[model samples]
Target chain A: MTITKKEVVHVADLARLDLEGEAIDRFAGQIDTVLAYVDVLKGADTQGVSPTSHVISLFNAFREDEVGTHLEREAALANAPDKDDENFVVPRIVG
Target chain B: MKLHQLTLYEAHERLKKKDISSLELTEAVLDRIDALDGEIGAFITVDRASALAAARAADDRIASGSPAMAGLTGIPIAVKDLICTKGVRTTCASKILENFVPPYDAAVIEKMKAQDAVIVGKTNMDEFAMGSSTEYSAFKPVRNPWDLSRIPGGSSGGSAAAVAADMCIAALGSDTGGSIRQPASHCGVVGLKPTYGRVSRYGLVAFASSLDQIGPIAKDVRDCALLMNAIAGHDPRDSTSAPRETPDYTAALKDDLSGLRVGIPREYTEQEGLHSDVSKAVAAAVATIEALGAEAVTVSLPHTRYVVAAYYVIAPSEASSNLARYDGVRYGFRNASGTDLLAMYRNTRSEGFGPEVQRRIIIGAYCLSAGYYEAYYGKASQVRTRIREDFETALEACDVILSPVAPTPAFPIGEKVDDPLTMYLSDIFTLSANLAGIPGMSVPCGFSQEGLPIGLQIMGRHFDEKTLLRVAYGFQNATDFHTSKPKR
Candidate 1:
């Protein structure tokens, strides 16, 4: 149940977060404390209980494929931190 | 009463009678905010020009004497920063979205606009609605109105504090665990978290989708019902929204609880760390309900202890996935130092997000990791099923369950902020209602020995906010707790 500093760094990487030396250790200690506390759930007798991802039972909300009124391109890019006239700008991915 | 201090219903009545203009009321509330918000730190943004313009438009609507004029017409209402407004900066109280303005209004905002409710401003909250105390807000911490040094219970703390301080007539706040009710309890106002699907979540910034719901924070039960009436409805945009019809919540606000069976959960009263003043207040509240002809019964939620544990796993798992959208390319803060895409993503997130948010993301990533998913997230989900069943069985015997909204009243601002587990435990009573997807509300019950407000919690069957409202209305009518305001 104990999360090590190395594991904390790995998890932070998985979450797209950069955790440095002290933050990694601090998060490791904190996460371990929380995990240990939540370990109390291990004693619950949930023998055959089905897991509930959502409380309400909802099916796929299908809609007819048709063009509808939507956000204009200008509005869509209004808040983009880095964007060109037509698209969002980002670091080059494909080498 | 001063125009700023008028309740939503009271203002509506005056507006209907042509006794006062919406412009005057909006001005009064704006003036109050101008005077008090410096001390309260309740609002992140207050748009005076837009609010005044909206009020004038509402005045025009009132002048037209249109038959379609609704109850909320011309009433100024503050929105939580998390809920999107078409052109307003909707920062879920985070640095990442500090400059982000949504292009579209949330479904609730659209509904409120349709009713001609004036938009006053956006209230502060925990960054990404992640913390129990508003101390986690990136902008600033919201102070409790009753005692300035104490924390306003959060992540809806700003909305609750705003309403309590009469900065706005009422407000809309979202609840995942106890965001709405806990703050409402601390601020001595009424708050309701409708059933998971009772209100649409189209633009609520996705905290924990399954557990998150939008509700009201207001001065009393009637105003809560009025706001609920305005916002509670199914929307196609939110696929999880229940297809069922929303009842007129105001019609359900009868002051008689003659047929109501109020259940007192033994585990809640006996739970450790409950403040003695809170216990006494809840006991007196139960007696008051009993005197109003409602029979008090004992009910058991056998999975009570497992709620906080299960919730930490489930909510964070959802949050980690939902928050993946903030990668810096599309809106929000970006770190300019990164030379590559992976570095860009990491640097942007690590810099944009605050410490509490990062802590949660790490916890979520760790729990849902390949090696531990079954033990953490999967086990928690199963325990969630057990928790839901506990409510189902308890509600079968009683019409509504009553308990203390929070174990204690508002604590000092810095008391539990650094201690995440202790802060998490403060929401012990309120999280179960969210896990069970039932409606829960908080009504002012009494005051602590230190003069802090204590609230009584009422929870009812799924999609049955009316019962919770009814019981709360009956209790509020019998007591003056809801009428008592803080002396600032």
Candidate 2:
């Protein structure tokens, strides 16, 4: 199955990416090539086989519900691109 | 031998014997990096001040007769750029995080520091660990020490290159799909990918969460084991960390391979693109194991053909979800040219991420998209189950499996960068181990006709790193391949 340029743009929008003229064409081609290669999975016989999300079977790794030492606000906000003293500043979400 | 060329164990012994100070060892390593890294491009950031301070502290600790001194005490070790180092700029070789300094040390970094291992620098990698070759790194591509024109296998290319060039005593590398072992094979060093949960993944910038594992790249098997001893264990921070007891990896190193059963997977040997030289070298390695009294047995992994197909779908899908957090808000690069929130995110991500990363994200999003999920991601997961079961059944017949690490040695820098499918196929042999959550390692086996190094890959049962280390140690003990260093 070939991926079209329109599909590529749609996927990019869903992925929150901006693809311009050349990049859109390039990504569409590359993604199509990869998809064509990976289409071999459709031939594999996986009847009754359960999908393995995690290789090691561990579940509900719960710790005690106690407050612990966490990253201080200053440190947490240290790498923020734009931040006030209290919170990170993004483009106004609710205009 | 120069102080910089000494293995982690040798350096530790000298420090313990008062024959050398940690300051001197660290200085030698820093000097090596200074002289060679300009050509090799192995380091993204060299923390000279912090490294020296840590070295001096280690020296004082040793002098104080502190009982806590460990193998990595006072040893300068490079870390791959993806693993978070507190206060150090940890860019996963991407523009998105070019200047980002992590707020805290990763779990492995914390463990290494507890052993007093000096943090020499953060090494380069594929941008967000996306590519097989370090060519995808935003800063620069890491050149193989053996051949300057060749690419150092990556996304942990810098870690392996640094170790091979003696820029550091040892280094930490993360393996998602051949990130550690492939580069270690190409650079002619030792690298291991512990079972998925064998090493805590906390603070490692996620690429493919289930498949990503932080392991060691070192000069030899013993040093790899030493680094593993320091880093492998359970942590409350990583939910996937194995709750099992950590064994003394060094204890697993014995010169005897007696009573060992080595599995030779027919599918691997018969796989397309297996280089003639690599096949010969691995054959010779199997013979060496047999001479050491190992019983060779043929094993079959029927699902080997589908590994790359399955891996690409699964890894990128997870990466797409994991990387969605980098949308110009909390940290990393931001392009403020956009007028709205959605536009800001799109502009920031497009401008920040490199081409290969953006491509993977797009592919991943497409795979996990509503209409295509069942055919691509879901089918790939089921194929993954068959691959895992293939290993389980094959491993039941033998103690460990051996194969060629890569189809061939390090290729020239730009050879496969444009051809992503070829690059993905190069990782075919290494991806199965990760897919199955089994421990795998690469040890230098022989040199190709053109003088590039070839590595023999040894894989073992889930959480059975000891046997892999044991087989590697035995082979290294019997052969001089691991001792052949790259000429400057």
Candidate 3:
């Protein structure tokens, strides 16, 4: 499970992160070391074991489908870096 | 003495008795922060005007009627920056969110406000709560109060140091792995990580959803309990919050350990690189508990060795997904130089995130990627089951498990910053409790030869924080370690 530079670039693409030059080399080296350590799980005895995704078993947690207090448009957009009057403005989505 | 030095319970009693005004207490704490925070680097932001204004309002209520005074009325509490504060800047100690003020308070912050607590400020933390040491904070490294050159264990280092230095009475900190407990141990304070879902996570900037829990860092065990009383409960905003009845956590603070069964996990002590001082202190603390009439027995958590691996895989996988929301569109920093939407995402993320955050994201995406998901994230989840079962089996024979919070006490600030794997291993003894969804706490046990503090960790079954608090309270009542202050 050695992490290669091309693999780093591929994963970075999927994650929408740009790692170029020395960062790519550094991340490849560091992630490779980490992956090697995590590979120890391959030897574990997990036969017929269901993965415990959530520690405490939770049932369907729901509330009545009624109108609830919600954040205002201004409040919701408080932290937005680029916001138009009513919506978050991102880079052009379509050419 | 400065009012900041008073414990939460003591301040509450005095506030109720009308001996000290909330404004006076708030001023004392603010003055202390003004004097000490520059050297300690504990607080990222201190909202003085708002704190004093809140304190005055608390005083008005206290003067109005007997029942008007809540337990935390006028008490200045520091909050970790990761927890959102309405109108107050909530930086997860990352440059990307440095000026990002939230429009709403976190659930825990709402709870504190309901009790009339004055939030002194937001404290520093490792960016996105990723690192074991606060060195990963983009702003500055939080220095340990005990020794300024050393680190305050993180990612709750700033909160721990503020409490240790008496800048605030008690602070709220989140523990994903060992964020709260490890730093509390290093700073010689009480830190508690309640059972997963014990505290609501609404507006807590998500790190690892399954593992994240917000708890109290206090001057002693009793204050931790008092703070817990104010903050722990169910919240509809956070779906994972357990729908269990909230108990008076302070009622569990009986100074006795008789008839309690304490289990010592052999795997913890036998682990290599466990500092001799930390091991000896834990062993001695167990002996003290045994003398207090609790029976001690050996219990095995055989899956202990695999915890670090499992945690690294699971936490980051979740983090990678959780952090996707911060893509520079709806919130925080944005680099708008890209020509297209996809390029915008890449360039924004590249410029906004720090090195450790980038590293974890890359690692997480790799683990959850289609081809590798089964071998990594899937297998890691099954190993998680084994770890949980190990705790369940051990708890069947014991009331609580006693262990060291971390392998070693706080190291020098820059010691492990370069080696990510070694830093990850520092959380070896702590990650299992999170994986098992149990409550764990740290109380000051002993001091290393260099005068750094060591923490004794007590872990109990899910929803059984009472037992953990009782045992820690019993131990603190018999020791003076928690009262020792670091010289400025």
Per-model TM values vs. the true structure? 0.99, 0.99, 0.99
Task: Report how far residue B168 has shifted in candidate 1, in Å.
Answer: 0.0
- TM-score for the B chain of model 1: 0.99
Interface RMSD for every prediction, one decimal? Answer: 1.0, 0.8, 0.9
Docking class of 3: high
**Residue B61 CA displacement from its true place in model 2, Å:** 0.3
- Tens digits of per-residue lDDT, candidate 2, B1-488, equal 99999999999999999999999999999999999999999999999999999999999989997856887899999999999999999999999999899999999999889888899999999999998889999989999999999999999999999999999999999999899999999999999999999999999999999899999999999999999999999998899998889999999999999999999999999989889999999999999999998999999999998999999999999999999999889999999998889989999999999989988998899999998998988999999999999999999999999999999889999999878889999998999988999999999999999999999999999989999999999999999998999999
Off by over 4 Å in 2: none
Candidate 1 CAPRI category: high
lDDT of 1 by residue, A14-81 (tens): 99999887777677888888988999999999898999977877778776788789999999999888
Q: Cα deviation of B423 in candidate 2 (Å)?
A: 0.6
- Regions more than 4 Å wrong, model 3: none
DockQ order, best first, reads: 2, 3, 1
> What's the candidate order when arranged by decreasing lDDT?
2, 1, 3
Report lDDT (CA) for all predictions.
Answer: 0.93, 0.94, 0.92
Which model scores highest in lDDT?
2
lDDT assessment of candidate 1: 0.93
- Which candidate's DockQ is highest? 2
Task: Judging by lDDT, tell me the better candidate of 1 and 2.
Answer: 2
For model 3, how does the per-residue alpha-carbon lDDT over B173-240 read when each residue is reduced to its tens digit?
A: 99999999999999999999999999999989999999999999999999998888899999988999
Q: How far is candidate 1 from the true structure (C-alpha RMSD, Å)?
A: 0.9
